[model samples]
Structure formats: structure tokens, C-alpha cells
Target: MAKPQVRYVCQSCGSIQSKWMGQCPDCQGWNTLEQEASQAATPFANKHNLRGGGRRIELASLSSEIEPAPRRPTGMTEFDRVLGGGLVPGCAVLIGGDPGIGKSTILLQAAARIADNGGSVVYISGEEAVDQVRLRADRLGVAQSPVQLGAGTAVRDILTTLESQPAPTLLVIDSIQTLYSDQLEAAPGTVSQVRAASHELIRYAKTSGASLVLVGHVTKDGQIAGPRVLEHMVDTVLYFEGERSHAFRILRAVKNRFGGTDEIGVFEMQEKGLAEVTNPSALFLTDRDRPVAGSVVFAGVEGTRPVLVEMQALVVRVPSGATPRRAVVGWDSSRLSMVLAVLEARCGLAFSGHEVYLNVAGGLRIGEPAADMAVAAALVSALLDRPMPNDLVAYGEIALSGEIRPVSQSAARLKEAAKLGFTRAFVPPRGNSGREIATVEFPTLAALVDHLTDGL
Candidate 1:
């Protein structure tokens, strides 16, 4: 008999501890620990389980001669771009997002694309029936009935279907949280059930050469739901993030084993479905109808894509003892503070008693240093009561010493800006080769201050 077990496990990381704690040490998450049935008597407790073999292996005998298989395209340009052109056969992908955030729409569209390309796709959804899915497809304008499954659909049925199909197949599980196995007595979405289900699915994907796309749920804090092990077991992880009140959604890659993880796919949510924003810079810059003070254009790079966005800042005198409020939207607050302090120390801006607020015009979050120049310009515009020229753009990083630092791909940034009708640009002196945009090179913050105030 099992020695009647007891222990609390962290739901996030699966770390087991002897006693319950408010915060998990492994994942540093509060209230994530939960009691689980003891594993002492389970088959997993024995190291000899699963193949009934000894665990010892000789490392010297292992061969590194495995050849990698070719990748297949998912059929969506934006989605394909994020996955480094296409999906690798046998690669497991996890996509997480809030409910009704278009996770199912994107995957369905991908399936249709694959089918159009003469590939087979199996889409399993536990949340919706086949008829409901078909209605949604018709509404999205795809209008197709390629493959479908309903709840109570067993994994054995899916495996059999794939075995009979000769074409390359892309399998999509609407959500991993809903899948369960009779082998595991635990309920679905529980730690054991999720892990066991994912393990089996991952194994099936590899052995069958089927590309698997698993949809996951995100927590209130925007992390993938279920144990963190789910993220580690997959080949790629993508998150759908955007304000629900808005109609735009951004799919960003958090982890990619076969490609760069910095890629992001922008989509516009409409009555029809999620439409790809091929030229995001243009879409983001559309609201700028006129040039205004405390507003400037910033050219930044997201992965290999060059983006031109607007930065707006406002400065006002505070009436109370509260430290001047520093509010930020679409950018990091601490980063804004760092830029503000740099401006005060290096450029000698008098902002001791002023309330400052900064924002990136779009709802997108930007982290690149290319935003530095535009941010600085906006702050100065508010300080000097002057607005940056509507047609002007800026891109560079500012050090604490007020020195302008070179940003990546300045030429590409300038080319993108020029395409958007920007005639003038401010850039770091060192990085500016003088071939792009009527360049206004600033060596230091002090020089920039002098240049802007000399004629005032």
C-alpha cells in the first residue's frame, strides 16, 4: 500500500513542497499552490515505468547525426512570418489568449489556407459543435467545411483519421485545457490531466509527423493557464494581446525553437474576422491628421520590420505636494522615468515640479531604444511650448550624459519614414551615415537643447 501521502504543489510550476506557502518559491507566484493526491502509489513513482527499462544510458554512445525535416507553411502571411516562414513538421505550438480574442478564428483561417494549398488539416474544438464552427466560418467569409470534430471526440479517432489521410496534415486542438484521458482519473485542466494530455499529444505529433497547434488560455495577469510545464513542452508559444475594448489584436512570439522569438503579427478585428495588417506602420500612423506640439514621429524596428509610430507627451505644473505624476501608456513606466531623469541630468531641463505624461499614439507596447529621440522631442516641446514639426521624425537612444546613441537599422528606419512622407529626421550623430532623411544629427542632449532654443 502507498504510505498515505501529503504535500502541496504549485499549480504554476508543479513544484512540490512539504508545507503550504502563500507564495511559490519556484515560480514566485502567490496563491498558486494547491493540494494534490499523493503520487507515491502512482505508476510515475517508479523510475522503471513507461517502457519497463533501466534509466542508465552511456552518453558517449549517443549520436548527433539526426537530420532535420523540412517545414510547411501555415498559409497565413502574418502568421507564417511569426513562425519563421512556416511550421516545422512535428513541432508543437501553443497559442494563448483571452476568451473571444479570436484564437479560434486565426487557427480556422490557417486550416483553410492549408486546405487550399492541398494539405489536410484536422481542427478539434471541445467548446463548439461542428455546425456552430461552420456558421462562424461562413460569417468570416471563408465558407468551407474541410475538417471538423465535436466534444466527446476521442484521441483514438483523431489518430485513426490521420493514419488514413495521405496528404500533409496540420492538427489543431481548440484548447488543451479541455482535453482529457480515461487513463488519468483527474479532471481536465487539473495539473495531472493537462500535463498527461500534453505529453500524449506531443508524442503523437512527433511519431505521426503532424504539426500540432494547441490553443491555451491566459490568466488575469496574461500568463498561459495551467502548469508552466505546458510552455516548456512545446516548440513555440504565441500570445494574443490587445485591449478587448479595441478592435485590434497583436500576436507576439514568446518562445520559438526553430526561429527568432522577437517577431509579432498585427491583426485588425472586424465584423468579418481577424484581418492581417500587412502595412502596420501606415495603419498606426493614420490618426495623425495634423502636426501638433508635444508630438513627434518615432521610427522603430520590430524584428526585421521597420515601424513609424507617434509619441505624445504633455507637461503641466502640479498644484499639490504629490511628486509630479508620471503616467505612461504603450511603454514601460520605469523606462519613461529613466528617460525623464536623463533629460534633466544631461540636458538640464527644469522638470522638478512638473507633471509629465507620455504615450505612444497606438495601443501597441514599444520597448526599443529607437523611441528615445521622439520621446525626448515631445518632452522638449512641452517644456519650450513648441511642437515638433508634423513632418519631422526622430529615432535614437539618449544616455544619462545626454549623448545620443546609434540605433539599429537607421537606414531602414529612414526609408520607412520617407515612404510615409517624413522629410526631416533627428538621429544619433554616430549612427547617421548621412544618406537618409534630411538628417539633423545631435551629438548630445545639450546640443539638441541649444539647436531647438537658439532661435527661440
Candidate 2:
């Protein structure tokens, strides 16, 4: 007879404790600890088993055998570009998005492409049956290829099928939360089940030299719906973020062991499917007949991708003395407040009792420091009731001392701006001197104010 094993696991952070606790020690969430069955407490059962462990071999005895990596293209150029060329073998990718965000559609399209490329692909659907998947595929007009569809949600059965198949298979789990392992007595979609299933899929991928993609759900707070450990176990994490009202969707890389974290893929949701946008800048910028106040174009970098985005700001006089509020949507509120302070201190602009609202177009968030100048310029343009010129682009970081600090990848930013036919650019003085644009170099935000006011 086997010994009875007992363990407590946090439903929030996946922290295992020998005994039950009221609060999670790691995340400090209350009542997150739950007891799992004794059979699921095996130390070696839940752990992922990768290669190159427990082998004592000399370095000199190992020969150099590096095979060229073959990337499975998705028939979408922009998607491939953001994936650092293509999906790598033995890699696990986690993609999360809101419900009805076309997460399933995108992966199914990729599976079709993989099959079209002469590669066998298996798509495991936990949310829908095989007939439902086929109906949607036919409705979307997706081509059928060497792709196999499974309707069950059992993790053990999925693993069995994967093991029975040979190499060169691309497996996609519609979601990680729906998979349940029979070895564990916990219910499906529980913290323990999610963690266990993710490990098993990762191990299967590495050992079989196959690429695996897991579609994960997001909570109402926009966080990936699973324990934090699930993210740590995966090789890459991608989040599909966009407003449901908006047609454009942005795929942002949050974690990537093989590539960059800042890479972003842009796609337009269409009736047929998600269409990749080749030139995101043009799509993001509005085609206005004339320059409008509260609008400015920002040159920023998302990983190796250079994106030009539009910033809009509105400054209105406060009706009462209750201290006007600062509201920002899509853009970071803290960063917006910091830029407002710089403008007030350096540019001598009094924004104390005014209600300020800032927005980044296309429903995308800007984390890069290069957007600071554009946000400032847009605020100033709104305050002065004059719009920035259409053919002008701006990017810089405003220091607290009122100096325009240099931003990373200035040269590349200028090149992208020029390629997009922007005739003039306002940049940091130290970094913009040798650039080709009709550059206005400013030592301080005050200098920028003086430069613009002189022409006005």
C-alpha cells in the first residue's frame, strides 16, 4: 500500500504548504489555501522533466551538433515579424486575451498554415466540440490541411495522443484552464490543475521537439487567468490586448526567453479573420484634412519594432475650486502627471486648476520614454489652442530639472520618422544634432517653449 501524502496549495500563487494556512504567504491573499488529495502530493509527479539532467558528461566529449532552426510561418507577415522571425521548436507560447477577441480564430488560422506547409498540427479544443470547430472553420473559410482536431478536455488523454504521434507536430491547447489530469484529484481549472497541465505540456514539447501554443484566458483585471507559476513555466507569453469596440488588436510580448519582450504585433480584426497590418504607423495616424489642436504624433520603439503613434490631450478650465482632475485613458496616468509637472515647471505653463485628459490613439499603452515629448507637445498644443504641424514628429524624455533627456534608439527613431515622410522632428539636443530631419534641438523644455513661441 502507498503512503498517504498531504499538501496545501495556494489558489492564487501556487505556493505549496505542508499544512493549511489562512493566507497565501507569497501573495498575501486571504483564504487562498486549499487542500489537495493525498495522491497529488508526489514531489516528482507535478514537476516538468526536461532534457540534460542527471547526466555526468565531460564538455570535451560532447560534439557540436547545432541544427538550423526551422520556423513555422503563420501566413501573416506582421505576426511572423513580431515573433522574432518564427515559432521555434520545443517552445511553449502562452497567448491570453478577452472573450470574443478572436483568440481561437488566430490560432486555428496558424494551424491551417502549418498544415499547408506540410507539417502535421493538432488542435485540442476544450471549450467546443469537434463539430463546432469544423463549423466555425467553414464559416471563416479557412483551408483544411493536415490538421487533426480533438474535442476532449482531459489532459492525460491529450498527452497520450501527443506521445503516440511522431515528431514534427505543432500542438495547440485552446486553453490551459480546461485541462484536467487524472493523476490529481483536484477539479479542472483549479490552481493545481492548471499548474500540473502546463508542466506536462511543456515537458511534452521539449522531449518531442514540437512547438506548443496554449491559449489562456484573462481575468476582468486583464491579467492572465492562472497561477503566476504558469507564466514562469512557459517559454514565451503573449497578450492580445485591444478594446472590444475597436477593430484593431495588438499582440504584445510580455515574456520571451528566445526573443525580445518589447516586440508587438498589430492585427486588424476582419470578417474573414485577423489581417496583419504591414504599416502600423499609417494605420494608427489619422488622415486629417488640417492640423487639429490636441493632436501630436509620437515616434516610439516597441522592442525592435519602430512605431509612430498619435497622442491627444485636452486641457479645460476647472468650473469649481475643487482642484481639477487629471484623467488619462490608455496612456499611463503617472507618466502623464510627471510630464504635466515638467511642462508647468520648465515651460512656465500654469496647469494647476485645469482638468487634463490625455489619450493614446489605437487603444495602445505607451511605456517607452520616447512618448514623453509627444505627450507634452500635445498638451501644449491643446493649452495654446493650436495644433502641431502634420509633417512633424517628436520624441524625448523630460527630466525634472527641465532638461530634454536623450531617449534610446534615437537614430533608429529618426530613420523611421523620415521613412514615414515626416519633414520635421523635435528631439533631445544632445541626441538630435547629427540627425537628418529639420531638427529643433532643445536643451530644456523651456528652450522648446521659447523655440515654438518665437515662431508663433
State each model's CA lDDT, in order.
0.82, 0.84
lDDT of 2 by residue, 1-456 (tens): 446678899988899999987888899999999988666434475454444356686766458787767777766776676667778889899999999988898888888887887888889999999999998788667746668989778888888777787865688999899999999999989899999999988998998888999999989999999899999999889989888878899888889887778799899998888888878888878885699898989988888878888898999998766779899988889988898888887678989978999988888778877788888888888888887788898999888898888888888888888888888989887777435677777778888777666653
| Candidate 1 lDDT over residue span 82-151, tens digit each | 8887899889999999888899999988888888787877788877887888888899877664654444
What's the CA error at residue 256 for candidate 2, in Å?
1.4
What RMSD does each model have against the real structure? 10.3, 10.4
Reference-based TM-score, model 2: 0.84
Model 1 segments more than 4 A misplaced: 1-69, 153-168, 434-436
Q: Which residue ranges in model 2 land beyond 4 Å of their true spot? A: 1-68, 433-436
> Which pairs of residues clash in candidate 1, taking residues 3 or more apart in a chain or in different chains?
293-387
**Native-referenced Cα lDDT, model 2:** 0.84
Model 2: worst 10 consecutive residues (lDDT sum): 40-49
